[model samples]
Target: MASVSTIYTMGTFLSRAEGLGQRVRVLVEGNWITGTPLSCDGHGVILDSGAEGQFLVRVEAISAASYALPEATVPRPRPHEGSGDRVRDDADDRAYEGTYATVASLS
Candidate 1:
C-alpha cells in the first residue's frame, strides 16, 4: 500500500481573466470558490470584485502546501506548446507563497 498526504491553503480571490491557454476553477475543500485564468504573473491575481484577502484549502493525498485546480478547470495560458511555461509556473509559485506567507505571518 502507498501512503498519501494532503495539502491545504487559504487565499483571497486575486483576479480572474479569460483568453488564457487554460481556464481553472479555484475551489476550497471541494467547494466552488472562484474561477481564474492560468496566465497570472508573479504579481498575483487581481480579483474582479476588487477584493484582496486569503482563502483556506486542502489537498488530498498530496504533501504540497498548495495545489492547482486542474488544467481542464483552468485553461492553460499557452496550448500550442503542450508543455508547462514559466509564466504559469511562476503564478503557481506566487499563489502558494502568498498563502504560505499569510499563514506563517499570522502564526
Candidate 2:
C-alpha cells in the first residue's frame, strides 16, 4: 500500500496562520474566497477579507485550500484592540471614512 499523508484540519491550519501573519485562500461551494486568517475553532474559521470585510466560514464548507500572499499587506491589529471596523490602505497611507463603535468595559 502507498503511504498516506496526514490530514490537517482546517482549524489547525488557521491557528498556525494566525501566528504566521499570512492569508489563506479557500474554495467553498465553487466560490474562491481569500482572506487573512483571524481565528478558528472546531466549528468555523474567521477571516479578514480585505474590501469584502471579514468572513466566518464553516470548516465543512471548504472545498479547496491555498495560500494568498499579497505583494503588500497591512499590519495585523494589536491583541488588545477590538475588531477593526475600518481598515487603512497602506499604499495610500490614508484612512477610509467609516463608523466604528467604542467598546467600554462596565467594570
Candidate 3:
C-alpha cells in the first residue's frame, strides 16, 4: 500500500512558498486575501497587493492559501499539424475548460 501525506505544517508551507512568483489567495479569519507572495518566515508572510499595498499576514491568521500561476506563464497551445485538438496536454485542457466555462456562464 502507498501512503500519501496531505498535511502541511506552517514551516513546511513557508519553505515551499519561498521564491515562487505566483499570485496567491489566502483565507484568514473569515476574510479572503489576495496578493503575490514575497517572503515568509516562522512569524508571517509578506504579500504584495499591486496598487493596494503590501501586507504582513501572521502565520496564525492564515487559514488557507491557494497559489495560481499567472496567465502569462501558461503556454498557449498552437494548432497541431492536422489534428483539431485545442490543447497540447491534459493540464492545458483543464485550464481551457475552466476559462470556457466561465465565459459561457456569463452569457
Candidate 2: C-alpha RMSD after superposition: 13.9
Off by over 4 Å in 2: 1-5, 71-107
How far residue 4's Cα lies from its native spot in candidate 2, in Å, is 9.8
Tell me each candidate's TM-score.
Answer: 0.20, 0.57, 0.53
The C-alpha local distance difference test score for the whole of candidate 1 amounts to: 0.33
Cα deviation at 65, candidate 1, in Å, is 12
lDDT (Cα atoms) of all candidates against the true structure = 0.33, 0.67, 0.63
Candidate number achieving the greatest TM-score relative to the actual structure: 2
| Residue pairs in candidate 3 whose N, alpha carbon or C atoms collide under 3 angstroms | none
Q: Put down candidate 2 lDDT per residue, 1-107, tens digits, no spaces.
A: 89989889877777788789788887777666777888888688877867667778888887777787553533455444576555445544434232222212111
41 Cα displacement, candidate 1 (Å): 2.3
RMSD of each: 17.2, 13.9, 10.6
Off by over 4 Å in 1: 1-20, 28-31, 47-107
Best by lDDT: 2
